[model samples]
Target: MITDGAAMGRKSVGKEYPSHGSVLGGKPNRCVIHPLQSSMVAEALERRNKDWIVRTKDATDLIVQVGDFSFHLHKLAMVSKSGYLRRLAFAERSGEENGSSLKIILEDLPGGTKSFELVVSFCYGGKIDVTATNIAPLYCAATFLEMTEDLQQGNLISKTEAFLSYLMLSSWKDTFQILKSCESVSSWSKELLIVKRCSDAIAWKACIDPKAFATLEEDEAFCLTLLANSHGNLNVEESSEKWWFEDVSTLRIDHFVQVIESIKSRGMKSELVGSCIAHWTVKWFSRITSGFDNLTPKHLAQKLQRITIESLIKMLPMEKNSVSCNFLLHLLKLGLTKQINSEALSKLERRIAFMLEECSVQDLLVKNYGSKDTTYDVGIIIRVVKTYALFALKYSEPRVCIVGRLMDGYLPLIAKDTNLTVDDFKSLAEALPTNARYSDDNLYKAMDMYLLAHPNLTEEERTNVCGAMQYHRLSQDARQHVMKNDRLPLKIVREFMLLEQVKMARSITACESNDHPRTKTRTIMKVTKGLDRGCLTPKREISMIRKEVENMKMQLDQLQTCKVKLQRQVKRCIK
Candidate 1:
């Protein structure tokens, strides 16, 4: 009696169909009476049943379904824009019986129709092979879909080399615009390298179109430096046969300085400063120092003085000797005669002192000033003595004396209390002849001898002597020697003496005070012993105890008064 109506309905249709009334419906036949109507019915059934055959629009759409989730043909095209899918076009679909489930059934299409199919496949959740035509579109589509894996695959397929080649071959304006769109540092660097390798400076200059040299940022500096170095020898000679030098004046020095300082501040390893300095120095040395013969004495003196001062202050200490000492000395003498500022003179004096302190004394005495034998000229001796005396008086005898007897004559000149004004010191210094010849050690010794003979000198005088002795190359032995003679007005020595006296007095007082504590302790112990021995009678103890008891009774009376007041308030509130 079972008519098997479902089987008859399927068999009578004369189309291969899914088993009728199976656990679930079998695969739906696309060739049913109305093909489109059948598909609509299948789709509706899929919604109702929660399961149905997935019929893709095309082979590519079918492939995407097997590998990735269902997607429209347009989406797949966008995802594979970098040509990644195109490269995988012939790849076999795994877990299939025929080894190839993505075979194209319809091969022929109208012109541009192939692209239309790809777009459709993409829209139908199908992945199209990425090709040059689809790359850009795919990138946009993948980015829109937020398909990170697809985007990464596209990037790999695109390759930096290919992109750079495209940039080089494409329109310069377009390439620059594209580069500007890159946001990440890595992407920018990659693009810049490509531009550097293929394009000329003009092209790169066009890209950034810098209006002024100062407009360069750190990244621009890196790019420009690379460009400049690649061009080779920025200071190359303009003329043939090496007749004319490179015209580096065209290179903006201010900009160069800015760039170098920026790089140095950022701790970069570029040698821009060094290269610029070397080049500029070579070009400007002659021009800067030209017309020496025409230079006025005033101008020459001023220029030399500035150079010497700058050299002394800024040049490495080790290189001071490399400078012309004679030139420095000549300028110093001129400065003195011209009555230049005392500060300048003071600096010159320090420089000379530094040089003398650094050099061997015997060399100065023998090589420059001649023999220090007893036959030494009186003029030399007098000049040496006077020079030392001026130095000692101006600063202090002790500071100069520390250098020895060569400065002894300077000691007697140190005033008792008043400091010699700069003008006074300068006048005294100018009066001193230039033939000073005493050794430094001898000067210190003589100063010490002079101080010892002048014990009545004031505190200021002693301080001046100590200051001079400590000034330059003064030996420790000489310092101690000057210190031993209280006649040398050294404030440190006097202060030290006063400090020692104060400390000693304090110690004596402390010792005396300590004796008082011991005495008091003995008295207390004796009294306690007398009490224990009953030498102190109970009557005396009772009187002392009664005093303590009376004090406690007064404290108790105050507390009772406070309690009475509190009770009165409580009784009134209860009422």
Candidate 2:
């Protein structure tokens, strides 16, 4: 009976259970097993008598140990099909301790223990159900065991080679399956050129229309596995040009990189390639951040993430806007967190700066998690904004204004954090040119929020913080708020007060100009129109004069309103 390596025991084979024979005649039939079904399959194999161990051990003359698994077999059964085993058997026979079983330890077997189990089964004339998932490792294990045709006809090496060729040429999904499977025995797969061949096949399929290839029944199962791996985020519909991305992204870094290089060599568009890199970053980094990879050690996972981000940066397309500005900012953020190389971080910063107008305030609000006494990574934003300001010189004024307002809107949010230093706040406020913001309402609001949060600022520091604001550009509402605010330094308040007086004086002069003598005379003539109709009685004249007096009183009330505004300004100035 067959069983897992972890539950090996002696059992007799029964004729009732049929073997899914080798790929020599026809493709093997096997169902994909879930973890629970894998155990079920093991139990079924045990009951059916396809033993992981040989049927009898009394005549066994050979023991092969791979990792924690041991296989007992007759020397004749093993030596006839394996050159390496034959040599080991001969060496054992020639030694002084020849009476004991010939023991061979494969410490670094290509596919580890389970794959070696398959090799042992093949040596015993058992069926080998080779599929895409096991093909690479099994082929490598067979190669390592030297199970070549020279040792026996229709041997493992020849059979697996044929299977590999057929699978690579059969369909798109099979080629990817082979490539992904190679990740288990990565170095050996590369050494045997399995990775290269599969990468080329995938690249060729990806470069042309995928409709040319057959979408066999197995591909549905393969796509479902990808969908599960990606947490149901991957769309594997044939209509999507990126149906292959989810499958390709499942590969480890080295294998994935090789496949990408192959695709690039086939002249795929840089934008599409960049998009793939972005997708991979989102998928894998989310895995790292979400803490789903519990099997991997923390430090090792971090190391892998660092490598992933660094490789992605190097793989980014040089074309402008190939990726969104938000993505570049995200990479820069992770790059900072991972402490990646400064050169790469610098590249991300510059790329972000080049497209800074596309960014929003929230995008730049990367929280500070370091020794810096700030609520956010204000320094990173400062650097990015400074670089963007320099780049803005060549662009249109509207674009510069966009970044300007983005920063303006960002300042108030960061200013509320008591830990944020005044210097960082001031640097961000003044990062753009004076003309970047056509109005300083938001900036003034930000300054007020900062001053309120940090009340211990020295007068000079307050002056420096307030210097970035242009009082004249402030909206009237902002101007009024500032005029009433007591947190502002006395010097700024006094300067703004002087400007307010000048503004009030200009307003009064304009009002007086509109009240010219001609206007007053016209108003009186309209009120006395009944006198011209010959109803010039004393009582009527008296009522007409009273109406003129009421008109004059209304004009006085308008002047009184202006006077009240001046008085309030004077009171604020005194404070």
How well does each candidate superpose onto the true structure, as a TM-score? 0.19, 0.65
lDDT of 1: 0.35
Stretches off by above 4 angstroms in model 2 are: 1-58, 74-76, 86-97, 171-180, 205-239, 357-379, 387-402, 412-423, 433-442, 445-464, 470-487, 496-575
Global fold similarity of model 1 (TM-score): 0.19
Segments in model 1 whose C-alpha atoms lie over 4 Å from true places:
1-89, 95-173, 180-470, 473-575
**Looking at model 1, which ten-residue stretch has the lowest summed lDDT?**
30-39
For model 2, how does the per-residue alpha-carbon lDDT over 200-266 read when each residue is reduced to its tens digit?
8878877775344435564454434434543345355532456566657767777778888899899
| CA RMSD of each candidate after superposition | 37.3, 15.2
